[model samples]
Target: MTTTTTLKEQVLMTLKRQQANALVLYLNYKKYHWLTYGPLFRELHLLFEEQGAAVFASIDELAERSLILDGQPVADPADYLGTATVTPSSGQLTVKAMIEEAIANHELIITEMHQDADVATEAGDIGTADLYTRLVQTHQKHRWFLKELLAKGDGLVS
Candidate 1:
């Protein structure tokens, strides 16, 4: 295949991975939101719902980007958990555990975004690189919010 074709395929694969991850994250957030209990329920339920909405938004953007590149986005909900790099949690978890899991998943996505952005840049696909950059920034912000909730005192670190 031509270099262009190969690069396009690689970019599409990366985008698909991201799309899967976002869907998994969105579901996990929604699940946690519904299952949240204890005194922190009010706050955590709202926060998880908000985060889930953000992740749901990213999912559409990723799929549209894939379509724009003339590639098929993964469409089956059943395929998401298998394709996603992020681990999905089921059952009950404490608020702190849920927050920690989210932070871990966001970090995973951010790391993958950085790597994918580099790949896109190297392949001379600036638009894909820009998309990955925006994704990284968004995940970073989400991570920060989760980390802050886990932080002690001044919220400088977690």
Candidate 2:
């Protein structure tokens, strides 16, 4: 006999995945913050830290949300890697590469948040849906910042 998952179960799964991703993404941002160099070091360092903090702030909310839904979040640090769709950063990378990687990560999270929010709404979990909606705004803002940094410019209107 096949067992079907309930809507609450689906929301719980999304919450757990989001919690894991937030932790991993926060660490990745910290890595980039520490390893950044070049002329933009100061700016990039500050930006990374700010962005990292914003992502980190969401972790507790996601975990608590799981609890509110009568589900357990991914609690162990060891499980983050397995549960998160957002991969951690490693190895050496230039400033540009770091920005690119962060932008990619933000895009991934934003996409997931959009889908997850829809699922929560469908499940009548308005609270979870609102959380995802708010969190996606943050990710989108970060992505826009990184994208603008990478945008081509010649300081000419021609």
- Predicted model with the maximum TM-score: 2
- Candidate 2: regions farther than 4 A off: 1-3, 153-158
For residues 54-141, write the lDDT of model 2, one tens digit per residue.
9999999999999998889899889999999998998998778788889999999999999999989989999999999999999999
Distance from true location, Cα of 145 in model 2, Å: 0.8
Count of backbone clashes, every candidate in sequence: 0, 0
Model 1 lDDT, full chain set: 0.86
RMSD per candidate (Å) reads 3.4, 3.5
Error of 2 at 18 (Å): 0.5
